[model samples]
Target: MSGVYLIGAGATPVAEHYGRSLADLASEATRAAFAGLPEFAAHRVGALYVANALGDRLAAQGHLGAYLSAAVGLRGVPAVRVEAAGASGGVAIQQAVQAIAAGAAEIVAVLGAEKVTDQLDDAVEAALALASDAETEALHGLTLTAQWAMLMRRYMHEHGYGPEAFAPFPVNAHANAAKNPLALYRFPINADKYRKAALVASPLNMLDCSSVADGAACVVLASERVAREVAAEGVPLVRLAGVAVATDTPALALRADPLDLAAARASAHIALGRAHLGLSDVDVFELTDPHGIAAALALEAMGYYEPGAAPRHAADGAITPTGRTPIATAGGYKARGDVAGASGVYQIVELLRQLRGEAGPTQVDGARVALAQCLGGVGATAATCVLVAER
Candidate 1:
C-alpha cells in the first residue's frame, strides 16, 4: 500500500465560540494548515473530509462538507462528512488515507469541527447524549457521564482503589494545560482541589469530566509520491504508518464484559501491528478522555499498563509531558476542554508539534512515534492511528 504523509495540521482554541459558526472555525483551521506550505497550491487538494457529530442537532446545519469546502475555497472536488460520534475525526483521517492508498486521490484535506455553544447548557447536554445508543442506552436515560461513572465505580470495586487514585489524571492534564494557550482551562490543579470538587455522579466529580466546547482542527495528507515532491523544512518525515478502527456492542448491557474495552484493545493492536511497533516503541500516546476513567480503561485495554495500574502510573508522574510514558501533552480533554469529534484531530495536531520539536514546554524529548485513539461512546467504536517520524 502507498504511504500517507502528514503534510501540515492546524486547530482552534477549545472555547465557547458562540459568535462563530461551524464554517468560520473550520475555515480558520484550514487556513492555518495551508499557511505552513506556501508553495502548495489549493488546486492540488483532491478531496475534503469534514467530521462533525452535532452540527444539525445543535446548530441547525448539516452537509458540513459542502459548507466547509465552500468556506475553504475548494471547488470541483469530492467532499463528504464523516460521523462516528467522538471518533469522527480519527475515522475521517482513516478515510482520507484509504483514498490516497487506493489511488483515488493524491492529496486530501481533513477537517474536524463542532459547534455546541449556540444552545443552552441543558440543550447541549441533551445533544451530546446522542452518542448513546437510542434503543438500548439513551432509552434508559443513561448519559455518557453516568456510564463512565459506572465504569469508575466498578473499577474501584474490582481493583480495591479509591476515588483519589484517579485524581492524578486530571491534575496532570490541568498542569499541562496551564502551559497551553489554546487550552480552555489555563490553571493547574492538585489532588486536594480534585478531592474537593462537587460530585456530579457517584465517584465522578465535576473535575472528573470534560467541558464540551466549540473547536476545529485540520490536517492535510498526501501520498508518499507527492510528499517527496515537496520539502517540509526543519522536520523529519511524519508518516501515517497505520490506522484502524474497531467496534463492539453499543449497549453497555450487551457487552461481554463492560470493563474489558474490547473494541479499544482490538483497535490498538491492529493499528500498532500494522505499524510494526508495540506500546513500548511508541514515544507518546494520546487517548480520547471524556472522563479520567475512560482514559484509564483505554490505557489498560491498549496494553500500556496492567488492568488496575493506569491510575497509579499517573500518580508516579509517568504521564507528564516529559515523563516515562508521556500522554496528553497538549492538556488532553480535561483541560483543553472536550471538542468532542474534533478532539481526535486535535490530538494529531498536538503530536505533530511534539514530533517537530515545536512543543516548547510540553515537548516529549525526542518523540519519534505516537499513538492516538478516539472512542465513539464508551467502547462501542474506537479509531486508532499510529504515526512514525522516520529519520
Candidate 2:
C-alpha cells in the first residue's frame, strides 16, 4: 500500500496462435501489458518476474525469466523466475511486492504462461507429482483427481451434498467466459451436458474438470510515485493492500481437518488484517479451483460458510458474477482452462478489469474490494492477495 502498485494487466488465449511457443506467448503478453500501459515504456521497467508452471517439462525451458527479459528488449534487468505449482503467479506478485517493499526496484513486470496442450497426458501426470508425497501420497498411487474425488466424496457424505450440488460453479463460469474474449473455453455449458459427460474420477465428470489448454497473463507494477504520475483516470490502478503466502502440512491425509485449509485461512486472515477489512467487506472473491473441491473447501475454510454449506451455496447461484456475491466472473480455472502459473495472474487481471469498469458485459457494478486466492498442490501451499480501488 505504501510503495509497489499494479499499473497495468493483460491476459491472452493459449489455444492455437500461429505456432507460438510458451515463451513466445509470454513475450507477447508482456508486450501487450506494456502496450496497455502507454504511460511507461519498456526501458522504465527495472525488474522482471515470470511465473511459469511447465518451464522444465516443455522444451526444457529452465531459465525463462531471462529468456523473456531479453525477448522483450529489457535486457540486463534483474530477472527472477517463480514456480509455486498453481500459485506461481501469486508468488510472482509477492516477489515483486517484496522487491518494491525492500526498495530494490521501482518498476516491475510479472508474467504467467503455460504451454499445456503440447503434452496433455504427460502434463497431467507431472502436475499430479507436484502433490505427491514421495513417502506417502504418491507412494500410495494417489493422483490429484483421486485426492479430489476423496475430498469431494467426503464433503458430500458429511454434508449431504451430491454431484449435482456443485454444477452451478462451472455453469456460471462458462456463462461469464462466453463474454471474455481471452478465455479458452468460451462456449456456454449446460447441466445436462455436465451430467452426461463421462466421469473421470467419480463425482467429477469431464465438465467438472477444466480443459487442458495454453495461455499467458501479465501485470506491471510501479512505485506509488510512478503510479500517480503515469496515468489518468481511465486506466485501472488498484492499490496492493496486502499479500500473504503460507504453507501447511504437505500430507493431506495427516491434516488436522482435511476440509480445513490452514494455508488459505492464514493467508486470507493476514491479508484482511493488513487491509483492515474482513470477509464481508470484500466486493469480489476469486479463489483458485485447480479442482472443484478446492473452491468449495476454500470458501468454507476462509469463513465464507461452514464446511457443509459451501456446495449448497455454489449450487444456489451464490458465486456467479450476477449472483449475490460474484466470483470468478472470467470462469476461473473451473471453466476457463487452468494455465498453472498464469491462473492466479488471470484472476488478478480479471479483478483489475472489473475494478476499472473495463470488463465489457461481465463487469461487476461498483466493485471496490477484491480478493484472490491461489492454492499450490492439493492444498499444501496457498497465497492470498487483497486489492482495493483507490480514488
Candidate 3:
C-alpha cells in the first residue's frame, strides 16, 4: 500500500456563522488548506470527500461532496459524501487514505462541514438524535444529553464518584481553549462554576456538555510520491501511520457493558498496532469529548488509564498538555465547540498543528506522534488514526 501523507490542513473559527452556508464554510476551509501549500494547485485535486451529519435536515442541503467540490473550484472531480454520525470526518479521511493506498487517487481533499446552529434548538436536538438508534433510543425519547447523563450516572454509581470528579475535563478544556484563538469558548472555568452550572440532565450540567456550533475543517492528503514533491517545495509532511474503524451495537441498552466502549477500544488497538506503537509512545491524544463522561470513558477505553480511574486522572491534571497523556490539546469538542461531523476533521487539524509546533500556548512540547479518535452515537462507531511527524 502506498503511504498517505497529510500535506495541508485548515479550519474556520468554531463559532456560529449564521451568514455562511454550508458550502461557503467548506470552501473557506478548503481555501485555507490550500493556502498552506503554495506549491500545490487546487485544480489538481483528484477526488473530494465531504463528511457531514445534519446538512440535509439542518440546511435542507444534500449531495455535499459534489456541491462542495464545485464550490471549492474543483469541478468534475469524483466526489462523495460520507456519514457515520460524528465519526463522518474521520471515516472520510480514512476513505481518502484507502484510495491513495490503492493507487486510485494521487491527491484528495477531505472536508467536514456542518451548519447546525442555524436551526432552532429543538430542531437541532432532533437532528442530532438521528445519530442514535431511532427506534430503540430516539423514538423512545432518549436525547443525546440524557444518554450521556445515564452513562455518567452509571460511572458514578459503579465507581463511587461524584459530579465534581468530572469537572476537571471541562475545566482543563476551557483553560486550553483560552489559548486557542479558533476555539469557541475562550474563557476559563473553575470547579466552583462547574458545580453551580444548571443541569441539562441528571448528573450532567450545561458545562459538561459540548455546544453545537457551525464550522468546517479540511485536510489535503497525497500519495507518497506527491508528498515528496511537496516536501521538496518546503512543506512539512505528516504521515498517516495508521487508520482503522470499528462498530458496536448501536443501542446502548443492548450492550453487555455500557461502559466498555468496545468499538473505541478495538479501533485504538488496531490503529496503534498498525503503527507499531503503544499508548505510551503517543505524544498527544485528540479523542472525542462531546461530554465530560464521554471523555473519561474514551480515556479508559483507549488504554490511557484503567477503567473507573479516568475521572481521578482528570482531577490530577494528567490529561493537560503538560501532563502524561496531553489530550484535547485544542480544547477538543468540549470547549473548542462541537461541530458534529466537522469535529473529527477539526481534531486532525489540531493534531497537525501540534505536530508542526504551531499550537502557540497550547502546543505540546516535542510532540512527534499523535493519536486522534472520533466516536459516533455513544461509541456505536469509532474511527482512529495515528500520525507521525516526518523527520
Q: Root-mean-square deviation of each candidate, in angstroms?
A: 1.2, 1.8, 1.0
Off by over 4 Å in 1: 232-235
When summed lDDT is taken over every stretch of 10 residues in candidate 1, the lowest stretch is 228-237
> Whole-model lDDT, candidate 3?
0.90
Span of ten consecutive residues with least summed lDDT in model 3: 36-45
Off by over 4 Å in 2: 16-18, 232-234
TM-score of each: 0.97, 0.95, 0.98
Question: Mind giving the per-residue lDDT tens digits that candidate 3 earns over 1-391?
Answer: 3389999999999998988888788889999998978555576788998999888999788888788889888889999999999999889989999999998988999999999977898898888888889999999888888888999999999999999999999998999998888899999999999999999988999999999899999999999998988898888889999999999988899999999999999999998898888989899999889778998999899888899999888888888999888887889899999989989999999999999999988899999999999999899899999999988
Global lDDT of model 1: 0.87
Candidate 2, after superposition: displacement of residue 305 in Å?
Answer: 1.1
Sort the candidates on lDDT, descending order.
Answer: 3, 1, 2
Clashes of each: 0, 1, 0
Cα-based lDDT for every prediction: 0.87, 0.79, 0.90
Residues 122-181 of candidate 1 have per-residue lDDT tens digits of 787777677877887777777888889999999999999999899988988888899998
- The predicted structure with the larger lDDT, 2 or 3, is 3
What global local distance difference test value does model 2 have? 0.79
